[model samples]
Target chain A: MTDDEVIHMEHVWTRFGENLVHRDISLSLGRGQILGVVGASGCGKTVLMREMIGLQTPTQGQVWLLGESLAEADARRKQQLRNRCGVLFQGGALFSALSVFDNIAFPLRELKTLDEELIARLVCMKLAMVGLGETDALLMPAELSGGMVKRAALARALIMEPEVLFLDEPTSGLDPVLGEEFVGLLGQLHRELGFTVVMVTHDLDTLSDLCTCVAVLAGQQLVSYGTLDDAIACAHPFARDFFHGKRAQRILGRSD
Target chain B: MLASQSSAETSALPPLSPPEFAVEDGTAVVHGHWNLRGLIAASPDLRERLCRAARRPDLEWDLRGVNVLDSAGAFVLWQAWGERLPERISLRHEQQSAFRRWQTGGIPAVRDGRRPPVPIRRRIIAAIAGLGSHLLAVLALLGQLILDLAHLARHPADIPWREISATIHETGGRALGITALVGFLIGVVVSYLSSLQLKTFGAQVYIVNILGMSIIRELGPLLAAILVAGRSGSSMTARIGVMRVTQELDALAAMGISQSLRLILPKVVALVVALPLLVVWTDVVALAGGAVSAHLELEIGYHQFFQKLPAAVPVANFAIGLGKAAVFGLFVALIACHYGLRIEPNTESLGNETTNSVVVSITLVILIDAVFAILFRGVGIR
Candidate 1:
């Protein structure tokens, strides 16, 4: 395990009955570093980050977080570590019954002991950080548009002021203009908070602009992992096809 | 092996690999290493062949020559009769070791026999555990309620009486008329049934005593509680389940709000406050209906029924019945909320649990009534 690493997956293998989704895969995330995991739909990038947050246990391997093995963490320790690692789910998993203010105030209420006034102020700040106005706080989840809901969800995830954030398909349903805006907001949040960000996305255009490091998942392994420049410089067919939007048939010179 | 003969006949037949079965004298015999994956791969063919051979009435699965089987393969053969094939495909075992393994709990993945699988033995244990968990949750909520009420008692100026009154009206007052009607019908039934036996003994006056005692002591509170359990209990559960499915509970968890305090405690407190009043109302209406029935059928005078009613059911009877109502109300509210909040993502679970909450609440109410009867009788309070 590296000293500065926030996440470490050593020889991780995950399986679902007869299907093996990941096999002997290993990767690490250093402090304040952003790792963009790019893969096709069934390649198991989401499961890797889920392991990092201790949401899933590897079938055959170990997951270590901040120098402590997650396998051995007690409930209290696990809760604390989970509070430190915030997650924004793929479909903007906001609580539909709660107003945006309650959504943003949830993590603070769960893990911190702050006065109501302070919680209100912090909620507004977090909301404003995501480009959602103060007036948007009282609206329920169903009332918001797709982009606004994502912003609200992001605000909720960051309520604890976590040291690391996991975003799954952050730009999944948004148009390009709003998707790029969300990425820019993430960039600003990273610049200000200096927290490590791990994003699992199929959107390859995000790699050059936002991600510092990229890992391409194929054949149930992290086939190539390094800086974006390294990924571009590599000659693997999967990475080449993914980054350039080359169809599998064009790259392989034959259709399957 | 039939592979050599078939290979000569057709070149395109994919050469039947190593594990082959040969037909000799109209009987097929197979031999090879049998692993779970290989057996699963040939399941379609095995199922077709088994169905054809086992079409006879009272079929027996002859696994005498089978070497080894895993849980999946065993279940496929075992479950095919009831689950898939539906005819008489009984599993017959002449081997001692295999029979012993089957009897001695070698099976790992057998489905529970109960449709919803609330096993009698396990449900008894779960009931005890569920009771303990409910008691703990109640104690915690009651402690908070006590603290809040104490604070309100200390500073009456901060109390929101209008809001409290509105909530009470919504939860209790609106339900009062229906509760009274149900109690009145129960009282009429009790009086009518008692008059039947009392007329033969020429003890018609005692019909007044029976109706007054049963309604005030037992049926009034019990019937009203069952009705509420069906109505409000189900409503409470559905409300919580919808909130849970929508991730409102997750939001509450995130915001650091104790869901028990925010959602359950207030509703429980409301029902607790309302149930005793409802029992009192129901008792009055039921006794009036009993008096009407007694006057009509038994030829007992209205004045006589009224005069003997107070003496028959003492004030202590009403008090004890109200206490039962309080406990029953708490059980109904807690069970409904618990099951509702525990709903998984499936809609089937929601529907089933809503029904289960009503059944469990009513069953517990009756069981607790029996225990209370023993306790009250022991204390000479009856």
Candidate 2:
């Protein structure tokens, strides 16, 4: 099971002082699969994503990325594993000081293995793939619109060609047009690049279209985990309300 | 905790195989893990080797024996061959799919890393414009503060003394201990040093004049101002900067609340009130410290030092110190609030502005003190 898993979390609990954000949570993501994480506000979906990426660690239990336990991997192993994955933090955490091109080239430069010439070309290609023009590369993060910032962040996340990509709330603040366009881009990149993606999001269209599986977090535990249809059919109260909610029903084109 | 974070304790690159190449009969044979993991270890050697290989008439990616190939590995291999199927090559199902993705998808081709450079003159002009805009906005905020103060004076009941007093308690009252500690320490060092020089001249009695004039008039207010600038001033800028980044300031503005009255005015008023009092407190503590040090070093009793201090340093010097403290306090708070309000909606701006607030205010305090020293030259020379 561990050999085939890209991400695996077991009995994970995250507590800030006295408040427990997650409890008794366990889940696994298969290789080459898209897993959409969803929950109500404050339910710790993003916390789970952070744990998998080693940005956050659980107070109890384990988080394994690409089959190596993050808590156990040595520095060298962790660095190797990190190079195999990418993360798009909430609000597109691009460095405000660097230009868009520099932000995208950041990981390549850090790897210390690639020449500037190759890094530049890779940055340009990523910009093009994310629907941004070459000219946009010179603009700073502050200069870009929200959608453009997200796209530029996405391009930066992809520059390394990681085997796994994790996104936190990829479409929350985007307008509907850009939201749809982003989902389309995600699908296209996932297919073309053949990387596993774990997105923490509440967007219904993304859940239905881009995700191969949906994991619902609620009441300090994973309430539901499966395909979108499985979530809609789940008996848990929050899962039922979420899938059969008026907005979700309208988006899914279902009467009940 | 990844490499991109840079703050991670692990700074060394992981050892992985850089792609290896060999020349064979005017052909290049490439082999190794160019997979998701191996590509992270791409070094100058691999690039140079690849570049040299690209010149070969026939290049072959003998992938039949190699393992660990992914998009990154395949992409680099494709790039080495100039994004085309090589003149002669080997075949495998996984390797074929990797190359096919490159053919069909977006991959950056190799090229010189160069961007059209901006002329130095243009950069300098842009920088000057930015600085000019910042200064102008700060002047505008100063005008708004004056108007708010006038309005509050006319309608005294509308003043938010509750918030203003609370801010004073938090920023000023809590700062007393550290201020006293540092001020006393500074006084001790100054007196001890003066005693050394006075002893050499056998004029130990004049230590009273030196300590009294410097601590009461110059060092006390300057020390207090610098301490507050570091402690309270940075905190004020950081608090307001965070409010801007989180859009709490926007929420206040949206509800038609006057930010000047509800936010900026209280901070400015609190500092203006707290600072002069703090300077007085600092002066008293420093004098006591100097008297104690003088007694220990010069065997001149506290009674003698205290008696001589009044005649040596005039009350006019103390008044000048008070005046400088008030002005310094006002400028520090105003500069802090100006930078805080100007913080862009980003985390980077919050840190940058907080640093600027403390640094710029401290520099201005010294400059202003120099101007005061020149203007009051005759008054404090008793």
Candidate 3:
């Protein structure tokens, strides 16, 4: 793997009992690129993403992240690798027992170096960046609205200033306006920090608006992986149907 | 400049330099990577140096040599400079935005001003008020339960038999093993201790009277109720609390379903039906345990102990135990459902309410047992 390659998978196979999810899937994501993985429901998009992040082991083959082989890394080395990446799960999995402030402060507190005062300042800055205020900090995760929960989860994800971020359906539950705002915030942060992003999304707007590269998964493999236009022009039946479908046509056409 | 320094290494990037600042000729020159990792690696010393440099009234800041600056680094500098930019400073173009973002959006205050401690008198008053509110809420729940029962009585077809059966299996069938173990052990202990005393007074034959009266009329129902309250009551509260957290209760309401009828009534009905049977099972097991211990310690035959139990304790006592068991079951179910409905949509509240449900149910069960003892004082005892 190249030094700039943030994620690399070769001949990765995922099988659940008798069902095969991925067959000989090989893909690589470079530094500072937003790569969107799109596929139909139950097509192993989440499983594939989970495999890339070392959360799940593929039945066969290898996956490397940030020049470290996931299969070869020990627990401590794996922990160090995990520190450099962030993930925003589909359900905004904030610690329900903690307030928003503590939730965002959790990762930094684990470092055991920074003082509470500095941590608080940093947490406040992140909350501001994500369009939350001081009052929102004291509220529990269960008290937050759907949009607020997403924002809070995003703040926690970016707390460590990770080199890479993995988002699972970042804008799925949000309305269009909130979704657009979230995509805008994501794009701005990406430009400023220049971190790599690997996102699994079904929203065409998110895929078209923020993704620098698109990978289409169908028929148990990566059918297309390239620029948006390259993915749209792919001759694969699933890829064509996905990119040239009515919803995709309207959204992609507007973007053009 | 540090980017070039990092790129100069071909195979692996050199370790990042921690943020450092030096006051050179009336200018505070700051350099190195000002990111989270770099700052953390040099936290205590770097923070002191930055604060000390920030204290100089005449020092101009120069940050042109810094290669990286994230929000954390920006925050450290922002805080050290007294939450504002230094009057005279030079920053690299890329690094300027990090500081600028903070300027445009005013820094949010982290700590709310210190809250004064409540006065002692007010604290007591607040405690009393909280108790009053809880009492009222419990009463309100009981009212709703009565209305639900009336509705079910009128519309027998709408009664939730399936849910009631499921709850019975959960609370009654699953609890038999634990209740039997505890009841048998208590029975054995009481019988053995009483036999030792009776042997001293030459009253060993009266062990049957002691064991039968206590186990049948009091200990049997009390032990079963307490165990069920601790085991099933907490679970019921947690189940409803989680439903509240996930907004499932609201969903049910939106679909025009009565929560009390569906959720609360089933548990109440099931416990009422189940606890009496459990008490009977516990009474029989405990009496058998007592008989075994009596035979061993006092040399009384099993046939003699069994034959004397009926004549020793009247049938009125058995009826009273069953009645007390039914009452305890009713209250335990009511208290569990009460706390379950009162839970707020948060995990901390869920935990607190579940604990309260078990504790309150057990306490109420004991209190009701005392009331029954006074009310039925002359009926069962010889």
Candidate 4:
């Protein structure tokens, strides 16, 4: 874990009773990079994401995010850390009772630094940033299609313009067309926003088109971490099977 | 890297961020972090920068030597470009996507206008429409249940005995502790108050009459029904609501399983059988509390109290109370299942339906009890 790195996990072990989700896992992410975390089911991908964002404390290791130790921080210090990051859960997890506008504006309102006018403008800007029109803001999460919900969640995630963004399965449940578009949107946001992203996903097209690096969690550890090609070439069985399998070949054959 | 930078006396070093412009005469030099913090720092200068850049004749822009550029920074530059990209900007290969996003970003030009705030009349109409659909669903469910019951009536051995037993264990067995505790408390309070009044008239023994009639004829069934409604009724709603939310109900329909017979009927039948017994148990527990109070306040022995209880309230009131318990139990389960089936695929609706089920069940129990009282006014009152 280097000082300038945006997120660093040093021997993180997330354990619940006898089950060790992550065992002595170490990884680091630099600023302005998008890292895709992929694994087979039950590989603790979400748990690792939760650890990076200070939501889950590592059972026996340190999690450093944006130059501060997340697990060791006080509440005020943690709030400062939290302010620099945004996380989108798998289900969009939008407050179902709130309108899309209010959901996007929630973090801004919580900061209490921006006026209502600026908040409204920024909310609209965020909605537009994720390809949502102005009129989509008034609708509830329940009214949105699955793809729209993901985009709306992405907008809310970006509303704060966080330094580090964590998206859990950003493209899952979307159609091929929408998935492609969403990945394109992500790549655009990564460039313009300059945020270090950690996304737990299973979509190969997303990794191919957008991820600057990939991390594979297997055997209860970060079996490999490097560029997508590096991961594909790595000899770890899980990594090899994940990135060089028949399905991967079909996907890679089609992408730029 | 920064820490390793040597302190220099003669610094002819390159500018950290001195973004040059093709049309230097008019095009503004964009510099520094384009991140959230950078935009926040530069927000105070937005108007001055935008106005000055807009008034300039030339609009050609360049981004070389810029330390960092983010969406927030790109947005500021776009604003300076009059909210549209110029013919060209000197963007590095890596910055191409960022620039494209800025050029295309903002509220879409064409949009369906937001609907006006729903008027009160329209909201009311919508609510009524929702209610109409819900009522229709409930009616359909009732029909399915009746059909299932008819089928079972034809095949007496086809009763879902396992599920009925489990429901009884859950709704009836698990709930006995709380019911007994609450019933005993209510009994003690009533006996204490009535005993005080009766003692004032030197008619202390009459406390048995007051406690017996009220406990058996009214309080016992109501108390048990309310307890069951809060305890079991809420669980039933939550269980079915989850089944709906998770599409388990749909899966059952797809599998050709009779949900009414397999799911709804067992709950109703279990409650119908268990609730009357619970009411009797509550009556016994509550009368025990009253007898204790009677012993304390009036020096009446337990035997005397038990012997007088039958004469004081009569067996007919007990039978009437059990009948009410059955009806209350059936209605509570129906109401709970109705709300459960209505749950949407959201946590908010689960909570809302659970609350509605409990409230509606308890309210219906009281309403039905009131109707029973009026309808059978002279039947149970000796």
Error of 4 at B77 (Å): 8.9
- Assign candidate 1 its CAPRI class: incorrect
Kindly report which residue stretches of model 3 are placed more than 4 angstroms away from their true locations once superposed: A254-256, B1-14, B21-31, B53-65, B78-91, B112-130
Q: Lowest summed lDDT over 10 consecutive residues: which window, candidate 1 chain B?
A: B106-115
After superposition, which runs of candidate 2 have C-alpha atoms over 4 Å from their true positions?
Answer: A13-18, B1-31, B40-71, B87-135, B196-204, B346-348
Q: Score each candidate by Cα lDDT.
A: 0.71, 0.83, 0.89, 0.82
Q: After superposition, how far is residue B148 of candidate 4 from its true place, in Å?
A: 1.0
lDDT accuracy of residue B40 in candidate 2: 55
Cα lDDT tens digits for candidate 3, B12-88: 53368988887889998888888998887764777767888898878999988887888788878987898799999
lDDT of 4 by residue, A134-247 (tens): 767888888899999998899888887788899999999999999999999889777666788999999999998888999998889888899988888778898878877889
Q: Write the per-residue lDDT of candidate 2 for residues A135-218, one digit (tens) a residue.
A: 677777888999999999999889878889999999989999999999999998887778899999989999998999999898
User: Whose lDDT is greatest here?
Assistant: 3
Best by DockQ: 3
Which one wins on TM-score? Answer: 3
Whichever of 1 and 4 has more DockQ, that candidate is 4
DockQ of model 2, rounded to 2 decimals = 0.40
RMSD of each: 23.5, 5.1, 4.0, 5.5
Candidates ranked, most accurate by lDDT first = 3, 2, 4, 1
Give per-residue CA lDDT, model 3, range A1-256, as digits (tens): 5668888888999999999999999989999999999998999999998998899999998887887678877798778778888999998999888889899999999999887887887788888888999888888888899999999999999999999999999998999999999999999999888899999998999988999999999989899999998898888998888888888888888332
Native interface contact recovery, all models? 0.00, 0.24, 0.50, 0.31
